[model samples]
Target: MTTWRPDVLGDGYEQLELPLGTDPDGEGEISATLVRYQPPSTDLPDRAVLYVHGFTDYFFQQHLAEHFAARGYRFFALDLRKCGRSRAPGHTPHFVTDLSHYDAELDEALRVVREEVGGGVLLAAHSTGGLVLPLWLDRLRRRPGGVAAAGIVGLVLNSPWFDLQGPSYLRNVGTAAVDIVGRLRPRALIPLPKTEAYGRSLQCDGWRYDLDWKPLTGFPVRFGWLRAVRRGQAVLHRGLDIGVPSLILRSGASRFAPRYDASVDTVDAVLDVRQIARWAGCLGNRTTIVPIDGARHDVFLSTPGPLAEAFRELDLWLEWLDGADEADTSGSRTEADDSDDSDDSATVSVLHRLTGEHA
Candidate 1:
């Protein structure tokens, strides 16, 4: 049996520990943390939203949960093993040799969510979590009654790290080197230039996120982890049918700034937006890709203007999804939503004002 208790966010939130026994990466016992949002007056919806955070992140976005709750969704977020509230003493910070290891916690989390909601689930993820969930969904689609049996109805990816950003040589040559070195020293940290630009922008811009969990420069990238991410990307590039429609949100521009500047607040300082748009089609199924103008890597975290636009886009997509679900129940094909392809163009124009032709 699992138990829920008060969360660090205080009031109306609770967390549960999902023990997964010993770690396969040789880091001793390991477990994931599941946090729930239950504010008074908010009735639990039949469907729930399961949100997964990206690398170097956890479930700290309380406003995000409330937003879902307002739309009648019971919100649940996971802090994967060794991340945020799940990190135990002596355990490495977000270190995993294979992304598949996360399957255990994801399965457990879904089980709990279904047990409580008894309806369908809407998947939501940010950055790396965006990558991890689709991969897991692809695999899950082949098991037993398929993804629908697991109660997953749709997916929403926020700036998913699709292809490894940087020069082409890094994806080709550097990947091979990382794989070799990763096998030799799995925990070896990859040397990267440190910068507090993005983190500082968030802090000074009114976001009071904990720096200890999500550091200014982020946790050191390990060779083993890089190798795992590369493998995941390779698989994603081959294409995957997640067996559900997906909504992908990303920034319209990407700017790599070594230090803090004005651009850090509006553009994606992490993954390339073009890369996100380029391979987004590979996700298969009916996919809608929307670029939020002047948005950060995490569109929801962007400063006032872009952040609101991001929410607007999300609301529109969810409304469309709800309509599609109703159509499916009324003997109409859910693909009917595709008849309005013009909607995609209109949404893009809303963001393309600043830059043109991302994907």
Candidate 2:
């Protein structure tokens, strides 16, 4: 456990907490952090984006926020309970028995974004965050007038964990064994080594980022967390209808051996990229899969060459969504203009009225 300093993010962001009351099992209070990235203007943004970070990671991507801002979208990121900025001294980093536990934080965050920014939010999540959001959205869809079916307009997943990244036997039997161990010793640290090559490939070794936020050596993998992740992966395998346009991005290939070589720079050594492409169709009807050559796990965090390519693809996609001539799949030309008078204003006003007392 390294002592973390609060210099991980840029200057304009505020750390806000949401109380989740006592844990259902009577453990303690559960809370989450909301990191806001307000645009440099008073006029509300026509679009909003909510970013969720991956395991062993936090909302440190200021560059990403700038990208969204440049395109006229207000961006926000969440550091879920027990992860990054939200992690308390006694709590385990990234530990949760059920993925559903994130709903409380996510629901509140969405409400805040919808109220303050007054628009449909595009969800952008990476890795484990990718896994968590879709399932959360699915659950939200079941409830009447839930956040998932309401404010979210689309989803953008970067290397989503659609399934476990090992042999079938290991995914099944090994996961079961790990689950048993997790039940017995939830907090016990287990070995889940991260390769140095991947770290180097991302330029996050030391110079690029503060070590406290994203440790080069990575964080411990607890049994409880692994079990929870395995459970979530199983659900993703069954498929989800998020009921929105989705963009799935991944490296072209995967390399998973001990040797740290230049190949690590080109492919996703952390996860099975093929699996990302295969199950991508399961997301929804308007899903688009784009494979970037020589990209890392978190595509935006890739090296300069691959990173630029990823951004190019992202810009093109956003442009297309904005009703550009090149790729207008939505077939709605006035969508962006129509957003000015969107029904979201009424929703935002109501949410503001409901949450005004808390503010």
Give the residue spans of candidate 1 off by over 4 A.
325-359
Model 1 TM-score on a 0 to 1 scale: 0.92
Question: What lDDT tens digits, residue by residue, belong to model 2 across residues 35-143?
Answer: 7776456775867899998887888888888888878888888988877877766676677878888888898888877876777798999999989998888787678
Q: Please tell me which predicted candidate would have the highest TM-score against the true structure.
A: 1
RMSD each, Å: 4.8, 10.8
Error of 1 at 299 (Å): 0.2
Worst 10 contiguous positions by lDDT, candidate 2: 332-341
Worst lDDT run of 10 residues, candidate 1, spans 330-339
Tens-digit per-residue lDDT, 1-359, candidate 1: 87899999999999999999999999999999999999886456898999999998998999999999998899999999999999999898999999999999999999999998999899999999999999999999899998878889889999999888788986798999999998899999899999989898888788887788999999999999988898999999898888888888888788989999987999999988878877887777777788778899899999899999899878877876776753342231122112133344565653232122233
TM-scores, all models, native as reference: 0.92, 0.83
Error of 1 at 333 (Å): 12
lDDT of each: 0.86, 0.72
**C-alpha lDDT of candidate 2 relative to the true structure:** 0.72
